[model samples]
Target: MKISLVAPAASLFAGVVSAATGPFLTAVDSQTWIIGNEIWNMTQGPKYGVKLYYKDHDCVGNAVGHYVSYNGAANDLAWTSARIVKNGTHSGVPFIDILFTAAEGDMHWVIFSNQHGSYQYFVNRALPTLGEFRTLWRLDNTTFPNGRTVTKDGVLPPLADYLPENKIQDETWRTPDGKGYITKYDWTSWILAQDFYGVYGEETGFGSWYINPGKDYYNGDETKQELMVHRESATGDAVQLNMLHGTHFMVSSSDVFPQGKMWGPWLWYLNDGSRSDALSRSKTEFASWPYPWLEDEPYQTRGSVSGQLTLSDGRPASHAAVFLGDTLPSNKSSLDQGSTYYYTATTDASGHFTIPHVRVGSYGLQAWSGNNSAIEDVSSTFTLPSLTVSKNKETDLGALTWKISEKKKLFQVGSFDRFSYGFAHGGDPWQHGLVSSCPANLTYRVGCSTTKDWCFGQSTKGNWTIKFWNPATANANKSATLIVSLAGYSSGSSSTIWVNDAVVGNLTSGSVGSDGLVTHGLASDPSLYRSATAAGEWRYFEFEVKPGVLKEGKNEVKFQLTRETQWHGFMWDAIKLEW
Candidate 1:
């Protein structure tokens, strides 16, 4: 299958060193150092420090903090402390470039300041142990998959040669410009540290340590990462390489996941460019950048937004999630909305919310109240007027109330938190086959069934049913409203609502939802990413239930989807009926 380019944000790496004393180590000159089967030639390109940007969420929005020099505490062991030599700004966003030393063992750390205050960025959790480091090596004279030799710099050779026979299969696609090709390959291997040290490390090797690509340069906490090799022409023409995991190159080698590879679909982008140029480009591409978006980009100014929400009953809508976006509510999330600004925040106990570090722009507001038993009776999404946000300023949206249609409450199932938090088979939705492994008759009955009776997701159509009973006082004469809140969906996913053997309505999940069924994850999980999406957002569908549709007796509301493959399905947040 062909895949498109997905640009996450970029990570900058400054100083990385690999030291070992063995027969495989050799120094060609002051500009070249050959260690084992790998060669590091400093003369090939200019060396530069890595840039670090501090933002609230990952690499999103303008820099919230600035980096000063490192703390350099003497009590810290493992020589994991790197240095920050310089600080600068791009488009008014402050950033720092860090440097490291290879004394005893190469370790690096950087200090940054945000709205909270200045703090040291610990590499491995909050502990002061072995500091992790990353090195960017431009492969020169490497073997290609077609049995050809790549003489220039910035190439890849079937991953590091130390890996055991990987049995990797390569898939290639021609570049859009028709000038080069991008190859996708799978790398499955891990380094046994004891064996690795014996072959590479000097005597008095440390006991336990975790070393991978620097966090400032890449996400050191990702599993299931992959590697993509790009080949460009010798004419110095810019060749774009699309990566799924945002950053170009990343590696994790240690004792993290002993059962198997700690990483999932990890990725590495290989191209020809100076280390300085690569580091600079990474800072520019940090978060909110969609695929195919590169240099000469526009940076959005930072701002904050605050508001208060209350239910129609005048009670505070506590613990609700508020969303701000440039466009009206749709299936598209901020990640898929390309250039469209989106921000999120959660409401406090008093129904007040403040979304900080939002890119300066005009936005419409939407809020979803889920998991709150006190406000579970409320239906439909809450929306407010469009407001403009100014740089370095706060936009206060006065207290607004969410009012649902005046109708008699009939029945409800599950809570609307935009997630399948309490459902059966909900935790770790990625395990086994979410579709085939589900129970044949996934029927959930009200009163008799608990939250554990309902499955989190549905890939099979007409297999799931919600059985509810209508009492003598039930109101079936007036038209009813049936709300279906979505937790996740696949591409081209749609579902039909059936009530008491009568057709109710259908919902088409737009192009911006997670394929959680096939991906084996929830839409909100960071690890749940597709080519065109960063993270999935929650959405709800409201269908008008005719007067005669929902009867005053036993009622069965069935949810069916257009299931064609394992990737087609929908994960529900909640289902409610009001007459």
Candidate 2:
């Protein structure tokens, strides 16, 4: 039985054809809808700024699948909310439908009811043939133990029923120990269907397992699909999901090693009628599943890139990193949607590097050497002629040289490795309590100060003093550059430098704001992963030191966070004085 729904006659959804809603408006054309107000805009950032466009055939136009975009660039349509659906009519008026699909491919919907004066929403699934929508915010359908599809018994239909015809069966699947069974359907669908029986059926076990299948595309080719199995264990025995090769295809399970491509999902069920030695048996079976990941490659459609890197002084930049990346958006976030279309490789001992299996596209090349306190750090962004890669070809950039800026250094506080590694609390930067525990007025003397004397980052708006001694007389004729390297900075905040009493340098804004002070890592969020690196992209601010600014005996330089709050702060990478 196909259970359709209808909205009430007089409600917030009255006169759908005659009235215009706040969020939803009548379409001006097949692809355009004139919104009543700005439901979402680009200035609001990614969370609320993203827009999804879908066609509503009921609005006198051809209906089409929705497409998603962030700011203005197109993004995948899956995994995002903000959907609009229109269901059956009520008293000659159409109303909004709230049914949605879950990541696990389950059907769920929301129902509305009248509270005091507004509407309240409740959620449930389409099972058990519930005539009323009063289930109250949960999918509480119990498991059925029958050995059939369970459509008549109030359970989710078999997964095969929803899959396409070509993907219905997998006859090549087998257990790790050579125990195999023949199924009328494809082996992949058959195994998933058998597991679906135990999964949808309730068991008072210590752990629960579910399948979350995902796809992996190599350079926009989606021929490979991987299963992501999640184990929700109550006893804390399961591991968390991890990303591999920047692909979202991941598995969360227990006691298994992750390989390159041949890695598959394994379930460890611990309940009644299960073996007591399941952990040991599962480990042995996991080892026997496959050898090194050896999947067939689409080399005919992909290409490779090779290049050599050398310092300005004609020395090999051994172990340096080279990147071939697409053009970044105007305002780059801390992490841009997981590094897709970006390829990286490391130089060999002789500074030769080769990146394999790269999709054919035009890319911008960048290279940077590793950290070396002996000499200054060197990095370069190349703007050469169009570098267009073609199919089944190897693009060689030949020999490339990086030029380092020459400077007569007087003194330096840190290296240009793009980190706050040596400063105080640098190793563990998430300690927000340090703002109150440490002294408000912090001071650092050039010769006597140790790494512990300097804080990793500044959290509040204040002036931190740095005292340095100079033996030479002050010379206004000779030019000097005071370089300040920052690893992270918050939005709408500024940093200013004052030498003795005159302002030397000021940074008013950045491309995009980052959370660096409270969480001293480059990653978007510290709760997801606490990184040892700095918070955001590296930015250099060079201030000129006027002749009379530096005195012979002693001079004071102040670094101030002019507009700072607890949440708005920046992390310092290094400071240097060069003539």
Candidate 3:
């Protein structure tokens, strides 16, 4: 049996559109929506920032499918309440409306009501069904499970729904009651006016709107056709949605590891599952910059860069690692230098790569295909051409053809022999057991700080362990080079590590190298490195695991700070294994 709905009369809806009938206008255009008003100020840092990873997600822990995350510190602060207003009439269906208030830890995840003598709380739910919000608020206390008190489902109308069938166009839609028309715009395609690193490209023009899929709920369901978005701040950062699968293709850019930043985005299920009438163009597609993320001025304008890689014979260079750099590194140990190269991507089988949302500034690209080579113009002395990016523009370098040349390799270790693990490549994915919990140190950061990349050193855990399995039985006979980037207090503070339950070396000796990178036997001493050092900063250390020590599998490396110092005991940004 089909459920029948009674929608408000069109004439009645039109008349009530003004606050005169109630208190405020219910309908809002894309131009006048709450884009920045819902900023989710995260405190944990960048690792939680939006990038296209967690689309259509729910309120989960550190999982990759959450809509927003902030510092646990900000969880107790007061936030503004959001009020919903209807934009047009819907097909006749009776619905209820109410006010919602956030609860414990600013979990804003609550819909309140009273059932008899007990209270019902609806929070942290999946994306509510279209035309019917699964939660409403009135009273409060706290009950789990289902609620049947004074509650009515709220609804949000979607912009369009064309997928696996056709594209959507801008058109009017109505409620099942055939009494109202939805005229507000929802989806936005923000142009590349800024780089992914909070760097803007254009000052003004050809784009009034920017795209951000901020705070959304339950976005990654495969059963529905929905969209999701996340934006940290006002520029560069963005999230992509797959309306077909009702999810975001997060793993697309493997290097866009989460950092942490602001976020917001809300979506609705299409009235019709397989089709939509979404707008193909908007004022942004034409021109304008409504809101500018005012930070440092130059960080605002953004642009794009695209090019093809080919070998001397005209064949494409497939699977080449491409990097657009602000600074150059000496080698793998130059963790700080590598971070200066903000943009990183791998080429497709066709040898073509495009790095969009690049900060408009002076930059160069380096390609690694068995050898390190720069993409440069014929007359240029550098390996790469002096490239430039303009706001709302694409800097296209037709084809970068390369010929085999003598070069040094970053890693000479054999077959996946170099097991690279670090916060720079996204924190420890293996069994990193902790003897003590790490304290949330404020100085901890992403990219380069003290010439080190990212690390798990933002806390005061005296004993922490990072373990891995050397599964290659055939490769078990050789020694492994364990290079680590780390820092700690030198005032009675000491660094210690146990490989395979055996102590290797100790660093109480103040003089390791001018650069502060300590090396036991293999790798260059600090004096040999190009990185500059100061009193209190990060340093590098290389330790060669002795042969006959590492068995076939299940090897462990334990780290402990011998003496208590300051700032989270000891800190590290990366851990590299090369044999």
Candidate 4:
């Protein structure tokens, strides 16, 4: 499956540091100190008492100079607070303390001093008990004053200032035209103190304590409250205020006073401590039309269609289609045509459907919903034999019985008879046998030829009778005759036997035999008889043309042959009918 890739948009404030200085800084030489000069440069004038001198002819004398020098001579009261020295020159001791105090609000201060050719800035802030002072910022002179400044309120100026004049800072935050300051709090000490201490302390005689606009802040007075407010309304219910260092203050407060829940609804927006509230109160309302509603039920087959859908109320929805295709509409195609054996169905109100009786091949299933336009499409293929029905016979195929007959060399035997018979002497010669006379007696006599040896060594003088019914009437009409012939013996010299048209009792000669053969007689018979020719020989016979006596629906013809000698046995073949 191929998936689409989306390109992410460029970040709007990618390199903007949430803190007063870039996170990384290094000093290369003792004379060159990397310092967060933006705080000093913005709060104090460019020619303040601090001087950062670069050795290799790098220091230039200009309004924004590489060597920042005061307007007065050194060591004098004016110079004490005015002239900043790099190497403690006779003109003045490098007023590192002045540059250090320039970067302070409240009691926290950062100072830079030359050592060899490199410079290092150190910090000193008053903590309750811990003597460890925290380092706030740093910068490399090569990169510093590059195009940044620290405002008196501790905010960094736009990079355009130190960058060549031609390069304009990207127009990001809209500038207020003819406005004295970009932000009303730009000149406030509360903002500067917030930048230094990262928290609003007690309100000063100068102005109101700088609490986050609309954010609840605990005041020292405990009764009256102060908060920043947006006079103009915005679309979203909540507003965002630049709390300066309030994030660190809140985190520190939570850590120090572990028992108090200092942090309210503010959630960290990113790795930085900046935060945004839950959108629960946002004016932008979002909603989905319908919901998904399928369980992980196994499909009947691999190709079977399955899915889920949901309703607008964010609840499980039923009857919504998850697929659509050739297999749908569980009902018949048309009222006049009746139902097809295969179709699809929607789930009940609970959204469940099982489509049975599908063809034993691949088919498509689709889902649909009346509410939402389109949800999703899944392609599946299933193979199941239960879905198919046999097309050939109208009758139910419960069981089948098939038989192979040895005597007739036929494939199937619908019916057969088990009987024995013999002929009576001088009774039309062909009508010499008494056929099927006893039902309880199992023994039958076989008549043997006078020329052949007989069983018990006695002359085979008497004729025997055998009789059976041919219930196979699948064949009818057209000169049907039963012919009997012998196997397992060579014979040319037996007396002629006869076939009769008799339905019961004595047989009348209808055909005569010659050379141990039953001749084609003029009349077709319901009863057929053949005389034995030789000892130990097996004779088999069937109807040549179906007899006229055989009725159309079903008829039985009985065949009987005499076995005079008791040792001679007979074998019968299944009756065969050909149309």
What lDDT is reached at residue 408 by model 1? 69
Candidate 2: the clashing residue pairs are 169-186, 170-186, 170-187, 476-547, 521-535, 522-534, 522-535
Local distance difference test, each candidate: 0.40, 0.38, 0.31, 0.22
The digit string of per-residue lDDT tens for model 2 on 119-215 reads 1121222212111111111011122111111111122223222323322122222223334321211101111112221222324222112211211
- The reply for model 4, stretches above 4 Å from the true place, is 1-475, 481-543, 573-577
Q: Estimate each model's TM-score.
A: 0.49, 0.47, 0.29, 0.15
Per-residue C-alpha lDDT of model 4 across residues 414-514, encoded as one tens digit per residue: 11211111112111111111122212122222222221111111112233223233344543343444433321111111222322343322211234545
lDDT of 3: 0.31
Strongest candidate by lDDT: 1
lDDT of candidate 4 at residue 537, scale 0 to 100: 19
TM-score for candidate 1, residues paired by index: 0.49
lDDT string for model 3 (1-579, tens) is: 011122333442333322122222122221111110011111111122111111111111222211222221122212223333122222332111212223211122111111000011123222211221111111101111111101110122322321222321222234344443331112211111111111111211001111222211222111111112222111212222212111111111111111221111112111111111111212232232211322223334578788888866565666565656543333322112211224555667777889766667666666644211222111111136368778879989888876642322112111111112223311221111120233332222112232223233433435545555666775467777665544222233455666776665554433454343432322111210101011112344667677777778776565655655332233343444556
Candidate 1 lDDT tens digits, 225-336:
2222222222211111212112211111111211111111111211122233333433433332321211112222567889789888778988876767645654433223
Please tell me which model should have the higher lDDT, number 1 or number 2: 1
**Candidate order by decreasing TM-score:** 1, 2, 3, 4
